[model samples]
Target: MANKYKCINEFVVDSYDENEQVEENDFFIVEVGSIWELQDESYLSDVRLMDNEGRWLEIAQSHLVEDFVKLN
Candidate 1:
Protein backbone atom coordinates (compact mmCIF):
# COMPACT_ATOMS: atom_id res chain seq x y z
CA MET A 1 0.00 0.00 0.00
CA ALA A 2 1.06 3.56 -0.59
CA ASN A 3 2.01 5.62 2.42
CA LYS A 4 0.02 8.72 3.20
CA TYR A 5 1.35 11.91 4.75
CA LYS A 6 0.20 15.23 6.10
CA CYS A 7 2.09 18.45 5.60
CA ILE A 8 3.34 19.71 8.92
CA ASN A 9 5.20 22.72 7.62
CA GLU A 10 4.75 24.95 4.62
CA PHE A 11 7.25 24.22 1.85
CA VAL A 12 8.06 25.50 -1.59
CA VAL A 13 7.54 23.51 -4.77
CA ASP A 14 9.42 24.28 -7.91
CA SER A 15 7.46 24.52 -11.11
CA TYR A 16 7.71 26.00 -14.54
CA ASP A 17 5.81 29.17 -15.46
CA GLU A 18 4.35 28.33 -18.85
CA ASN A 19 3.36 31.92 -19.51
CA GLU A 20 6.84 33.23 -18.80
CA GLN A 21 8.50 30.95 -21.36
CA VAL A 22 11.63 30.67 -19.27
CA GLU A 23 13.67 27.80 -17.86
CA GLU A 24 14.10 29.50 -14.50
CA ASN A 25 12.51 28.01 -11.42
CA ASP A 26 9.09 29.22 -10.37
CA PHE A 27 7.94 28.30 -6.89
CA PHE A 28 4.71 27.89 -5.02
CA ILE A 29 3.97 26.91 -1.43
CA VAL A 30 2.19 23.87 -0.14
CA GLU A 31 0.32 24.92 2.97
CA VAL A 32 0.45 23.07 6.25
CA GLY A 33 -2.16 20.36 6.79
CA SER A 34 -2.26 19.34 3.15
CA ILE A 35 -2.38 15.59 2.63
CA TRP A 36 -0.07 13.72 0.30
CA GLU A 37 0.65 10.24 -0.98
CA LEU A 38 4.03 8.76 -1.63
CA GLN A 39 4.47 8.34 -5.36
CA ASP A 40 8.05 7.37 -6.13
CA GLU A 41 10.57 6.24 -3.49
CA SER A 42 13.67 6.55 -5.58
CA TYR A 43 16.13 9.33 -4.98
CA LEU A 44 14.74 12.76 -5.87
CA SER A 45 11.28 11.28 -6.09
CA ASP A 46 7.84 12.91 -5.87
CA VAL A 47 4.69 12.89 -3.79
CA ARG A 48 1.11 13.53 -4.87
CA LEU A 49 -1.18 15.94 -3.07
CA MET A 50 -4.70 16.97 -3.87
CA ASP A 51 -5.77 20.59 -4.02
CA ASN A 52 -8.99 22.23 -2.79
CA GLU A 53 -10.51 21.87 -6.24
CA GLY A 54 -9.60 18.16 -6.39
CA ARG A 55 -6.58 18.51 -8.61
CA TRP A 56 -3.45 16.59 -7.74
CA LEU A 57 -0.09 18.25 -7.45
CA GLU A 58 3.33 16.63 -7.37
CA ILE A 59 5.80 17.64 -4.68
CA ALA A 60 9.46 16.82 -4.62
CA GLN A 61 10.82 14.17 -2.29
CA SER A 62 13.18 16.66 -0.68
CA HIS A 63 10.31 18.02 1.38
CA LEU A 64 9.09 14.63 2.58
CA VAL A 65 10.91 14.37 5.87
CA GLU A 66 11.38 18.07 6.31
CA ASP A 67 7.77 19.15 6.03
CA PHE A 68 5.50 16.16 6.21
CA VAL A 69 4.48 13.53 8.75
CA LYS A 70 3.50 10.01 7.81
CA LEU A 71 -0.18 9.35 8.36
CA ASN A 72 -0.21 5.60 7.85
Candidate 2:
Protein backbone atom coordinates (compact mmCIF):
# COMPACT_ATOMS: atom_id res chain seq x y z
CA MET A 1 0.00 0.00 0.00
CA ALA A 2 1.04 3.61 -0.43
CA ASN A 3 1.95 5.93 2.44
CA LYS A 4 -1.01 6.88 4.62
CA TYR A 5 0.55 9.48 6.89
CA LYS A 6 1.89 13.04 6.48
CA CYS A 7 3.27 15.64 8.88
CA ILE A 8 1.64 19.04 8.91
CA ASN A 9 3.80 22.17 8.52
CA GLU A 10 1.95 23.95 11.31
CA PHE A 11 1.21 23.07 14.97
CA VAL A 12 -0.13 25.81 17.17
CA VAL A 13 -0.86 25.89 20.92
CA ASP A 14 -3.25 28.44 22.33
CA SER A 15 -4.30 29.40 25.83
CA TYR A 16 -7.72 30.31 27.22
CA ASP A 17 -8.64 32.95 29.75
CA GLU A 18 -7.49 32.81 33.36
CA ASN A 19 -10.74 31.02 34.24
CA GLU A 20 -11.11 28.82 31.16
CA GLN A 21 -9.06 25.96 29.70
CA VAL A 22 -8.32 23.93 26.63
CA GLU A 23 -9.70 20.55 25.80
CA GLU A 24 -8.58 17.48 23.91
CA ASN A 25 -9.10 17.36 20.16
CA ASP A 26 -9.73 21.08 20.11
CA PHE A 27 -10.48 22.21 16.59
CA PHE A 28 -7.88 24.49 15.00
CA ILE A 29 -6.45 25.50 11.62
CA VAL A 30 -3.07 24.39 10.31
CA GLU A 31 -1.14 25.61 7.26
CA VAL A 32 1.75 23.87 5.62
CA GLY A 33 4.73 25.02 3.65
CA SER A 34 4.48 22.11 1.28
CA ILE A 35 1.82 19.43 1.44
CA TRP A 36 4.07 17.31 -0.74
CA GLU A 37 6.79 17.50 1.86
CA LEU A 38 4.53 16.17 4.58
CA GLN A 39 3.50 12.66 3.69
CA ASP A 40 1.37 12.20 6.80
CA GLU A 41 -1.33 14.59 7.89
CA SER A 42 -2.94 12.43 10.57
CA TYR A 43 0.20 12.71 12.65
CA LEU A 44 -0.74 16.31 13.26
CA SER A 45 -3.79 15.50 15.39
CA ASP A 46 -2.97 18.04 18.10
CA VAL A 47 0.08 19.57 16.43
CA ARG A 48 2.07 19.17 19.63
CA LEU A 49 5.56 17.83 20.32
CA MET A 50 6.19 14.77 22.46
CA ASP A 51 8.89 13.58 24.79
CA ASN A 52 11.23 10.66 24.17
CA GLU A 53 8.11 8.57 24.57
CA GLY A 54 4.72 8.81 22.83
CA ARG A 55 3.10 12.05 23.88
CA TRP A 56 1.97 15.39 22.42
CA LEU A 57 4.09 18.49 22.90
CA GLU A 58 3.53 22.06 21.93
CA ILE A 59 4.58 23.17 18.42
CA ALA A 60 4.61 26.61 16.92
CA GLN A 61 1.67 27.21 14.58
CA SER A 62 2.21 28.19 10.94
CA HIS A 63 0.52 30.99 9.00
CA LEU A 64 1.46 30.05 5.47
CA VAL A 65 -1.11 29.20 2.80
CA GLU A 66 0.23 28.00 -0.49
CA ASP A 67 -1.04 24.45 -1.06
CA PHE A 68 -3.79 21.94 -0.51
CA VAL A 69 -3.66 18.34 0.67
CA LYS A 70 -5.64 15.30 -0.41
CA LEU A 71 -5.98 11.68 0.68
CA ASN A 72 -3.87 9.27 -1.29
- In lDDT terms, which candidate is top? 1
All candidates: TM-score: 0.55, 0.19
Mind giving the per-residue lDDT tens digits that candidate 1 earns over 1-72? 767778898877654343423236656677788876655533224655555544345556676678888886
Model 1: pairs clashing at backbone N, Cα or C within 3 Å: none
- Global lDDT of each candidate: 0.62, 0.34
**Runs of candidate 1 exceeding 4 Å displacement:** 16-25, 41-62
Alpha carbon lDDT of residue 48, candidate 2?
35
Quantify how close model 1 is to the true structure by its C-alpha RMSD in Å.
Answer: 4.8
Per residue, candidate 2 scores C-alpha lDDT tens digits across 15-44 of 333233556555443334323222223233
Off by over 4 Å in 2: 1-8, 12-20, 33-72
